[model samples]
Target: MLLGDVAHLRTGDKGDISQISVIAYDPADFPLIAREVTVARVLRHLSGVAVRAATRHELPDLGALNFVLEGALNGGVTRSLALDAHGKALGAQLLDLPLDGDAES
Candidate 1:
């Protein structure tokens, strides 16, 4: 599936509950980039962890993508992991995305 294809994901919140937020980003695909940082694919690549995900919207004008994820922090990776060590959560998520044109260098 294309990175932009993911729209929504469901995961634990507090007591088997989950929270969902629409991915946000700059018109320059900042949201897409941010979501990628937390994308399930990247998590799997880095530590073999799986995250739930879904696409929310595509801002073609700005060339950005928005996705919802489940239990983004279910793993200790969210708490015990350092930003540098775990990657900027968002950046780590985008590791496998095929973004083109005006990519945030």
Candidate 2:
């Protein structure tokens, strides 16, 4: 199943680190999100970006998972040449990360 089918994304950044939170639309879908939205998967999905490290933080009570990707900015926002320097672009791109089949549903 597509991740967008179960959850939505929110993103922000500080220095060269990008943080993304995947929040389930319904608590029922948290299980699927927890199982599929992994650090390895996110790294692969965002392979184009030079991510130095990634950490996944679970917020079961919020039905969400937060990923902290380090060195994702290429450089600090002011120093980076990427068009969307503050990481606004990554959030939308991240939504396309694939989920295997419809098993999670």
Candidate 3:
């Protein structure tokens, strides 16, 4: 299953950093997201982008996970030549991340 099947994403960027938030559709699904969506996994998933490092912040109360990715924007909107330098599309890409099939419905 894809992460988008159980959650939605929001994205933001500043300079060379990209921030993405994944919010579970059901609170019960938060645990699965938290367990599977680690920093390592995110970095691996977005390897095409020049992500130097990543950090995952769990927001259990909000049933969400926030990831901060460094060097993802290629140098931010004003600096990068990339079309989507702001990284708005990155969130949608992340939604495509595959989740474990054993996840509870």
Ranking by TM-score: 3, 2, 1
What is the alpha-carbon lDDT of model 2 when measured against the actual structure? 0.85
Local distance difference test, each candidate = 0.40, 0.85, 0.86
Candidate 3: C-alpha lDDT: 0.86
TM-scores, one per candidate = 0.34, 0.90, 0.91
Q: After superposition, which runs of candidate 2 have C-alpha atoms over 4 Å from their true positions?
A: 102-105
The digit string of per-residue lDDT tens for model 1 on 1-105 reads 334443322222332112333233334445555555344434444353334553344445545444444444444444535333232344334534443432332
Off by over 4 Å in 1: 1-47, 75-87, 96-105
- lDDT (Cα, tens digit) per residue for candidate 2, span 1-105: 688877899989999999999999999989888988889888877888899989999999999999998999988787898888566688777777667653422
Model 2 pairs in collision? 1-101
Q: Write the per-residue lDDT of candidate 3 for residues 1-105, one digit (tens) a residue.
A: 889999998889988999999999999999999988888777777778898888888999999999998999987778998887565688888888889854322
Model 2 TM: 0.90
Model 1 lDDT at residue 96: 40
If the candidates were sorted by their lDDT against the true structure, best first, what order would they fall in?
3, 2, 1
User: Backbone clashes in each candidate structure, one number apiece?
Assistant: 18, 1, 0
Worst 10 residues of 1 by lDDT: 8-17
Candidate 2 residue 6 Cα shift, in angstroms, is 1.4
Please report how far candidate 1 places residue 49 from its true position, in Å: 3.2
